[model samples]
Target chain A: MTARRTWATARRVLAQLRNDPRTIALILVLPTALMTLLAWILPDSEWQKYAPPLLGIFPMLVMFLVTSVATLRERTSGTLERLLSMPMGKGDFVFGYAIAFGVLAIVQALVVAGVCFALLDLTVRGSAPLVVLIAVVDGLVGTALGLFVSAFAQTEFQAVQFMPVALLPQFLLCGLILPTEELPTVLGWISWLLPLTYAVNAMQHVVVDTQLDTRFWVDAGVITGMAVALLALGAVTLRRQTR
Target chain B: MTTAAISVRDLTIVRGPVTAVDHLSLEVPSGQVIGLLGPSGSGKSSLMRAIVGVQVMESGSIDVLGQPAGSPTLRAQVGYVTQDPSVYSDLSVLANLRYFARILGVTDDSVERVLDQVDLREVADRLVGRLSGGQRSRVSLGTALLGSPQLLVLDEPTVGLDPALRRDLWTLFHQLATAGTTVFVSSHVMEEASRCDRLLLLRDGRLLAEGTQSQLLERTGCQDIERAFLAIVEGGAS
Candidate 1:
């Protein structure tokens, strides 16, 4: 948990990503592209109504895909083992990854939110910074969850498989398609257990409510708490040896 | 007595049903190049991993640099290069070295120093993915060389390297030893055993012999290390 080592680990991850253009596009460009497409295909009124929730969803989805596969690659390539053999602690690696991906998540959220407000003419009742804040928090949740999930996967292919199994259900149950309260009791309870539900609820609150409210703070707190918990779990579960 | 660079006492490691390392005990002195010579599955890599504090052991103890093996204090003191090239393929050789140098808490100049030592200065800017397998291995080795670590545990570093490169690497190993770095390198090639200052012959997760080339040869009544190794293996079997 040395701060200098953790920062070094984070800088190393960023340097690796800097050398890779495709990953850069995936991290920084894909969210903006997807948001623009949503604006273009849907009618103006529909786009305005749907953009807020989708904004929360896009960063989470993209960050999850990127973080899981990247971390899995680190495992398969023996880079993680090499790092572990050095003085770096498992916490350093996990937190380093969280911080690195957290930065990328902020960049991603800003790009997506900027496009939604500036280019698409989408408006929200609350502060624009709040929208960006919720999006960034959603991205952090995705990053933490991805790190936690990568421990269960032995290969990059299996990491990709986890997305549909682990994340798709959360997407379906997070009130994007239908309101949670409108669903069956069991299903609504399940949605309540998911971090994505809190993320979506907070973003929706920021978009529709003019003033900060208790519900908004509670939702944001839950999302942040989930991220921290998952990151701690990831650090605990990380295996240093490939065999 | 001079302090041993590494001391393992009755170390045992099990992977699944197989006992990969069985009650192995040895001492590696400082400022020497020792080779752990064994076949592919003889637990050479596993033993090396244990010495570097990465492998889980069933029993016994390993002390490195006056600390328990794998202690936080030993992190910068030990450098390890795995069988597989562990550098970031996307980054150039210099970039990979720089990253590891930072992790080792060394200045960036250490990167250039290691690159020069491994004779990779000309290709410092080349991406590791684009380098040949041997060159990529040198980059991995270069990463371990940062901070002039007290002990270097390299697992099968020359497995796929050309004879010329292998010779060059052995020369570098001796040079590092001359500069007071203890090197514990693993190799399956019998001919390479003669190049080491001392040898630990392993078979089926146990040590067959531990001594200089002539000592092993004389003890086994064989003319060369290769025949001596075969004789020892045969005698152990019977």
Candidate 2:
């Protein structure tokens, strides 16, 4: 893939997002707001116990929603087909989207982490920077998964429908709602198949373990590997024309 | 002798159980405005998509600009406009063109030139969503015009345009042809047939005739291209 073409695609995507104020607010504000709301509503002891894992999950959910709908919009509007007819390789389009959303994920992670640390006065035993890293990776995984899912959806409504089918199960089983260790063996085995489990596991380690140890590295590696695999799958599944 | 801009031999495309383009063979000479005239569902758009390398064919082969159709090398030399206007509605007209220009490796200034070519300079900064349908189609056309591609495949670009706008677009097509760009335009409207330097009349996925407006009329002893087309269809049936 040509770097210049990929960069151009990324820039164009960002430019389009700039014009969409609602989406901008959703991308930058929604996760932070949800985190703040949760922090305020929960008791101090429970907040301390739950905040870090919630932070990991929030970025994934928001990025998945935004990227899937946005990419699906391009498909439904026929713009993706038009772009494909150009000299652009499938990698350029997919990577361009990944880079663009990756940048947004960085901003999203930073905003949520900053608010969690500075405003909410949340304490992480592990390195705070590690929390941000896990969050960013979580967002990237969301982006990759969204791109992959958009290929199967014909309309934005159908894309939104994927949240319940593809993402909600991860939320339930990834130790966000119930701890994986506490889950039934069959349910826990299913959690191993999800990328978000590793993201949540890594972030939870940063919150409780106070150090980047073997567990953290393994979880981070799995998350990164899943992101790459999903991105590649997205590239392969992308159609030149909607049939 | 100059090579045909596009050459197809027994091109057949089937979608599900139905044949969309049936063993079609034709040659489009360079630097000419060739119109693909057919009724709706006559495989006009499918034929255009195959030439641009986007549609899969059941059989047959297409050669565009001396290369195999849909070759990566031909990507820069060929431009295609789909039947629907495909510009991003959220983007300004200039931004849409600039995006495509960059993808095509054309200079940034090419965006302005294409906008000017399509008479969209006045609304360059307007969001495509705010533009009229005809205006949006012009923006889509302008995107295809970027880099002055050698072969432009336009599918039903003038469907909803006013008569004057349609005439203006045909003039632009002729201007591009005069500058040595081969234009392959598709339309189901019979009236558009006469505007083309060469015409390929299609029915139910097969070609009925391929010739100039006058040649078609003379061959069928009809005064107008539409009647000429009807005559040929009737004669074939009889």
Candidate 2 lDDT over A4-50, as tens digits, reads: 88999999999989999998899889999998998999998888878
RMSD per candidate (Å) reads 2.3, 2.2
Looking at chain B only, the TM-scores across the models are 0.97, 0.97
Please give, for residues A22-61, the per-residue lDDT of candidate 1 as tens digits: 9989977888888889888999888877889888898888
- Deviation (Å) of B67 in candidate 2: 1.8
Error of 2 at B164 (Å): 2.1
Q: Report residue A107 deviation for candidate 2 (angstroms).
A: 1.5
Residue-wise lDDT of candidate 1 within B80-197, one digit each (tens)? 9999998899888887888788777899888878878899999988989999999999999999999789899999998899999999999999999999899999999989988999
Q: After superposition, how far is residue B29 of candidate 2 from its true place, in Å?
A: 1.8
TM-score of each: 0.93, 0.94
Candidate 2 wrongly placed segments (more than 4 Å)? A152-163, A241-243
Query: Which residue window of length 10 is worst by lDDT in model 2 chain B?
Result: B229-238
Per TM-score, the best of the predicted structures is 2
In the order shown, the chain A TM-scores of the predictions are 0.95, 0.95
